[model samples]
Target: MKRLAGVGVGWRRQLAHTLDTMEGLGFVEVLAEHLDARGPLPEPLVRLRERGVPVVLHAVSLGLGSAEPPSPERLTWLARLAERLDAVCVSEHLAFVRAGGVESGHLLPLQRGEDALEVLAENVRAAEAALPVPLALENVASLFEWPQPSFSEARLLSGVLERTGAWVLLDVANLYANGLNLGTDTRAVLEAVPRERLAYVHVAGGVKHGGLYHDTHAHPVSTGALMLLEELVARLGPVPALLERDDAFPPPDVLVAELDAMRVALARGVARREAA
Candidate 1:
């Protein structure tokens, strides 16, 4: 598969016009749940494809970490959408959003034990078989952790990749949030994953509420997250990285500036790699 490179942003309806005219965008990730496979494609997205900008379908409802297998219908929808758009790949969180007929409405962390890892692997393989393109699993941010985790975050992520042969959608912002809230060693997590398996990176903003850092995509990209992005890029080389903003839509210039900041981080990483 052709790997995504350079800097990009999450494609939302609010940013369609901005992205359509934005220069040097490598690709855009669309939330799969927000689109209907049976309906006509959004004009801006179609235009993006026409311009040779790759589109990656990011699914939120797959619940790949649930004990139950992934829903065939949802997998089918993702496959259909991917084929329709000629997407680069299909990405989803390594999280469970529902269980036992109850929806959590949020991406929840999984138990990083052997049994849970086995279940996650099974679900990922099932989804991979159903999809037309490659699958990339993302690490999510969480406010809490399951007690007595058998595996560290790095070990669990490495295990998933080793077993499923799926790509890693490294979310630097999520890593930062986890580090702040749960005391995760961000660099350790980055060093554990094989650089070759990394598909892309996600950088977003969050705010510190009370005593915890929330991975709220509604805020500005934190400096800590950008630093992590730089570190990852330095280790992995020029992989595709994106800026994500889900709410409190900022002005076009602000988004562009954020993208520019990402570019600067990426450049610094590249320069450091060269120096080393």
Candidate 2:
């Protein structure tokens, strides 16, 4: 698979015009659920595909970490969407949102253990088998973790990657939240991820609410997250870095400024690596 490179943005209808006019964008991700498997893709998305921009299919409801396997229909739709858009890859989170026929309405942390790992590994394998392109699993920001898991966060992810041969969508903001909430070193988490298995990286914004950091994605990227990203770049050189903003859309200039900031941070890290 070709390595995802440079900086990117999540393609949203709110920012479609902004992204459409922007120059030098690396790629853009669209929600798989929002797209139809049939033809007649979204106009802006079609324009982006026409411009030779790589589009990644990101799924929220796959719930790969759940006990149940992802819906066959959903997987088939994702596969069709990837083929329809010529997507570079399809990605989902490591957390589960549903169980026992009930939806959590949010991505919940997985109970780390043999059973959970096996279930997740099975789901990932299923998705990988269905996707025409590669499948990438992302680490979510956890509000709480299960006690004394069989594997560390990195170990669990690495094991899944080893078992399924899937790549990682390492989210720096999520790592920062997890580190802050769990009191673990974020850099250690970064180090544990296999650099070669990284499909891309995610940087987003969040806020501290009720004494806990939330990966809300509605705010600007935090300093701590950007620092972690810089450290990651120092270790892995420059990989594809995608900025995600889910809601509370900002002005086009502010969004562009954030991308510019990431570009500057990545450039500095690349320069430092070359100097070393």
Candidate 3:
């Protein structure tokens, strides 16, 4: 198997310094905004591919698990875009961003209970049917709680993936951030989801404000987040691990150094797991 390491960043648009640095770092996936079925990729995305990096479509507006069906127009857009890139896969969150026919411009949480399964299943099927590669779903960062916490995040994710036979993109920092904010046990969160569905892992840094831990995707990989990732690696074993630094991108070389550190940590984890 390949080493399965990547320096991943969100968005294809660029600033002179940002694009130069990203190109230098040799990121594997440029999480593109427009994987719609019919439009041409922005010039920068074409450039990223020219450098031999693969692009994956991570849509902000694709809200598959929403109350209503995801827009056919958007799905068509994604299908066209996927064809354009020969992408590995397309990813969206386990989120309901639109409700009652209104776009919230954010990934809003559903009250994670029994009522959500049918809706999620329907959306997953729709999303999978339209894409060539398996549709991977990500766990979202939540700052609020429901009056009734129906199922753990893992169970919900596991259920949907199992039903749709889709892939999962596990975000460790999202789990850590939710754990800190909601006082949820991280191990229990880990235990509830199906480890087998984990196709890749994401690690990012966040902000601590007003006694709240927010998944802001700023800063460097924190000690606690890195520790949690180490734990995840031990349990789940090797997966395509990547860092998501959407904002305040350090110079390209600096981010690559951080990616190198992450690899060292992952190697240590794999060794410990194998030894035990």
Candidate 4:
């Protein structure tokens, strides 16, 4: 598998022109559901590929953490997209989007227990077998967690990696939100993730609404999330990080500033590691 390096941004139609001419752009992640395998490739994306930039395919509806095995048709879509783009890897959330023939339209948290772990592992293995490239599971932020579980978030993630041999896509923003909303020990969870298996990092913006932090990609990246990202970089050493903006698109300069802030955080992390 090819290792992703430097800073990146999620590729959206709104940012196509900016991305096309943006300087020092390392790579871009595209939502897999937004594309059609049989259709013509987006011209800008093709241009990026021509420029030797890596494209990663990220899926949101795989429902890998569901009790049921991943849908074969969804797996096929992911596989075909990866092949179409020669993607560096395919990423999905560690949450279920649907259950019992009903769509939740949200990434619902999983129960942190032996049974849930087993089901997740089985689904992940199915996804791994179907994907053309390496699979990376991302930890999601949820408003509420199950009553009691046998495992912590880090332990559950470790269990999944051990069982499926998949990579980790650490989302710093999600971690920050989870910590704020669910009283999670953010630093402990960060320290527990296996550094060697980390594929990349996700940083996004969110807001505190109704006394809870919501991981909304529409806002500006928060200071707390940036700090968490720096901490992760300090531990892992120059891992690839990407800024994700899904809606309420900001101007190009603002987007560039966010990426710049991320780079600054990365630099701070490197300095801290060196000092240590």
| Candidate 4 Cα lDDT to native | 0.93
Tens digits of per-residue lDDT, candidate 4, 58-80, equal 99999998888999999998899
lDDT of each: 0.92, 0.89, 0.71, 0.93
lDDT of 2 by residue, 1-276 (tens): 667778999999999999989899999999988877896788988898899888898999989988888999989889999898898999899999899999999988888898889889999999899889999999999889888887678777777877888999999999999999987567667887788889999999999999999999999999988888888888879889999999999998999899998988888777877888
Q: What's the TM-score of each model vs. the native?
A: 0.99, 0.96, 0.87, 0.98
Residue 250 in candidate 3 has what lDDT?
74
**Which is better, 2 or 3, measured by lDDT?**
2
The per-candidate count of clashes, in order, stands at: 0, 0, 5, 0
Clashing pairs in 1: none
Q: lDDT tens digits, residues 200-267, model 3? A: 67788888989998887668876677777777767767656667777776776676677777777777
Please write out the lDDT profile of model 1 over residues 41-98, one tens digit for every residue: 9999999999999889999999999999999989999999999989999999999999
| Candidate 3 structure, TM-score to reference | 0.87
Question: Considering lDDT, where higher is better, how would the candidates rank from best to worst?
Answer: 4, 1, 2, 3
In model 3, the clashing pairs are 36-77, 36-78, 37-77, 37-78, 37-80
Off-target runs (Cα >4 Å) in candidate 4 are: none
* Candidate with better lDDT, 1 vs 2: 1
Q: Cα lDDT for residue 112, model 2?
A: 80
